[model samples]
Target: MSEVLVVRGEMQPWTDHTARQPVLAALLADVIPANRRTLILGPHSPLLIESVLAHSADVTILVRSVSDAEQLTETFGPCLHVVAGALDGLKRAAAVQPTLFEVATDGVQPFEVVVAADGLDRVLGYDSEHLSWTERLAAVRSLATPDAVVVLGLRNEFSMLNLLDRRPAHLRHGDDEWVPLHDDPTRPVSVDQFQAALPWPAQLYADFSAHTLVGVEAAATARPGHLPTRLAVAALESVDTPLLTSTTEPLESAARAGLLPAVPTSWLAVCNAPTPHTLYTHSGPTTLKATATETGWETTVGVVTPDLLGTVGYDSTVVPARVPGGESVETVLFRLAAAEDVPGFRKLAAALGEWAEDSRVLLRWDDVIVAGDTFAFGISGWVAPESVDKDDLLAAAWLRFHRRLVDGHRRHPWPPWMIGDELVSTWLSMSGVTLVDPTPATAPHVESAYAEQLAWGKQLAAALSVVLDSPEQTHPDLRTQLADADRARLELTELQGHVFGLERTLGFRNKAMKTRENRIRELRGQLQKATTANNKIHSSRCYALARRLAQFRNPRKVAAKARRILRQNLNKLRPAS
Candidate 1:
């Protein structure tokens, strides 16, 4: 008796960002037909699986656990044959015809399409320790029939985001249980390395952001963003100033190899393995080359390769929504000029949009604000032209601020707001010296006021510029006061140093006095003791006899000299008359 596959009915809703159902649905819908027998290695994108089910696609799902298989069967119904087993088990089952318990072995001899959308990381583990990427690839290969199309998704180890953001987005986990413990390869393989590892011929596309995939031969490229590839590349390279070897090597390799894209956050590879499934028919070259024309930019946006250009031609109707911003006028002009040359006006338009935005919100609101002086005014629809003279605009804004101060003094008695460079840039978009516009309206009076403001603003801005450029003459008294303050500070510092020195000297003196007092007390005690001893000797008859004998024994001249010396010391101690 053979054991039957048991499917568990309980499973949680898929929550991983990597499980991008919408994108997978769109991609799979284009490639897989309604009636093809499909084998899904992992139920990562349930939406994709459900979408294909509507097309009456014969599908077999292979899952890691019985619970996953049961949950999939419960959701998808009996139409989905959920097999709870490893890749090896599935391969063995594929060789046999349907038995009493065999599910997917019925009509279809082998699966025409095999998809491991969860990627090799799921199978081999990201750390590359559980199984080699090559081994995982072979396992995916074995699941399919001789002519099966395999769709895979892979992670780019050397992406632009990984280089710029220290903690890259990939590091984040979908859930606590799904934390990616697998470390990236110590030496990440490049496109060439990846290509070399491929079991078959493939075409790779530069897919931006996440959700990139690897497909079998003749795969279509993903949609490009508002920024064109050429422009995007230039922008990234120009700003990659701190490009370390880790970053530079990948970029240089992509450029030098020519087959790989220079600026995508991710990539997709389409392998060439002949399959019964027909690939989606697409137009345009796989590559593009942007060139400047007299009126606008001429960009060839189609399938372009290093050596070959595909049938698709450049589309002329595209335009950039905004222009890119830069620190300097030269940079802005350069980007603007580049945008003009590109076929789509999208880049130039994006930059223009950004410039207009800057003209409105350049000022940091709180910086120039005086808490109680002026009411806050919001500006909208502020647009800047290509040739903006920032200095002229700033000066005009400053002059208007000054005018408001004067007008307020006579009418409202409110102080004028302090103008800063940012504020000047912001208000310069308005008509000359206009303080505020309470309503959003286009009146004839407003237009006239605006023109007058511009004329007056130009003059005021020029005058303000002159005032700021020239150094103001200092008052003689102010200079003298500053000098006096400096001298006072020096004297104070010196006095502090002296005070510290005196404190130290006093401490030493106090210590010496204490020592001297102790010494004097000790001498007094010794004198008292001597007096007692002498009294005792004088009272005793033996002492008097011995003293007389000594006096007689001593020379008379020595005694006389001693008496004179003692009298001299006694006289010296007497008070002066």
Candidate 2:
């Protein structure tokens, strides 16, 4: 068995530029093997594969979403597989590469929550006390296609250690994974189930010394683990989580799948009654009807004809759904028939064959049909049992269609029938199926009342989420409102732009005016001082000329006046000019 290596870390955040490149780069670096069929699963892996096509390795990469990858392949095109419908996308991806390396991307179709296989036994070592999961890995390898490997990628975006060190207000239980239900009755099966979800469970869970695992079977006598079923779970639940895992707690990590409550056995039993559904088979289709008056409501299941599927098409409220691409299915309308009235239902189904040409119709009468007219019919609806064989009905139709050819087979013999393939396949699928050894506890020993209470609690929680995040559900009206909100936001942004522009213009104008005003004031003050000095010098020159004229007549008087005039002129010229 090829060793499964789990490489996990906090990749870069989902940003506007590249939400998940580091994660992809890390995966491509570690997971890819030469000449091996590797399935890499992520929302953005197609984008990464687009990058990977440049590396000319002889590797065939089967992509999930073909439309998304088709554009990418123009640049880098390895072998590509893209499903038309998003729901069937992953299944097609699996067909291309049987083994998968999954990066858990939220909000993508065929949204795989877990890549872990269902069954594996934990091997216990005497010295180390670690359960060796090599057997489990081997089983997975056997189930995997030839030359393929399964790898599950995990990302812890929020560091639990960070929470522990800082002791953030949001952190719960101080970074430790706590358990509420310690003495769980079904502890035997816990490790196995938990390990199945994990790529390397035994090694990963070996840490955490706080977990003291006291075997549930030893502790509880009445539990089914001690009985013949031997089915149990080493259940773990945080004491704080059960007490305070409120509706408001953040999921914290992208890969944190919220706790999925166990399917209590009693609820399964109560839901499963051995009531066989009445079925009508024809050439093309098998129809089933089961109508029982339960809690005063008429319960029904299965289709009346080729046209009417139970809930998918019967209600006008449901969106019309179909597989993408030109798939062959004839269009026909069906009138609801009351299945409780068995004779009326049989009559309705019989008449349907006559209603169509060449009596070319097959109908599956799965439920009881009561009263119905030609145009309109009433239905008695019942909850479908889990064991209802849908493939059996399809097989019956195929068999009927095969038998039609048998009449003309003397002219043309099918080698499959003549060579004996029909016998082998049918016996394996539908020859009064029976298990070799079954236990009474496997029949479901859970109490119905307790099971109902848990289911009610779950439903209540679901209802609360719907009520809180009702706006987020992709309903038509909600989509319209969201679009309107986006438009309004754009308009507001434009208005803010205008306001910013106006503010900038005002600031520029104010600064320019202040500069101009300061320059004008300084210029005016310098001009005034220059004028005053010029005027004072002119006066001194005039006085000196007058004194010189007077001194022409009397020498002594003239000398005295001339000296005084010269001194005054010198003072005025030196100081003012």
Top candidate, metric TM-score:
1
Tens-digit lDDT track for model 2 on 257-319? 311111111000001012222111111122112212211122222233323332112221111
Tens-place lDDT per residue, model 1, 443-498, is 65453323443553455444433322223323222333565689799999999999
Q: Give the residue spans of candidate 1 off by over 4 A.
A: 1-18, 54-56, 92-109, 124-130, 164-188, 211-266, 272-577
- CA lDDT, every prediction? 0.43, 0.29
- Best by lDDT, which number? 1
> Where does the lowest 10-residue lDDT sum fall in candidate 2?
264-273
Which window of 10 residues has the lowest lDDT sum in candidate 1? Answer: 362-371
Clashes of each: 32, 31
List where candidate 2 sits over 4 angstroms from the true fold: 1-20, 45-47, 50-67, 78-143, 154-196, 199-577
In candidate 1, position 289 carries an lDDT of 27
* Residue 59's lDDT in candidate 1: 73
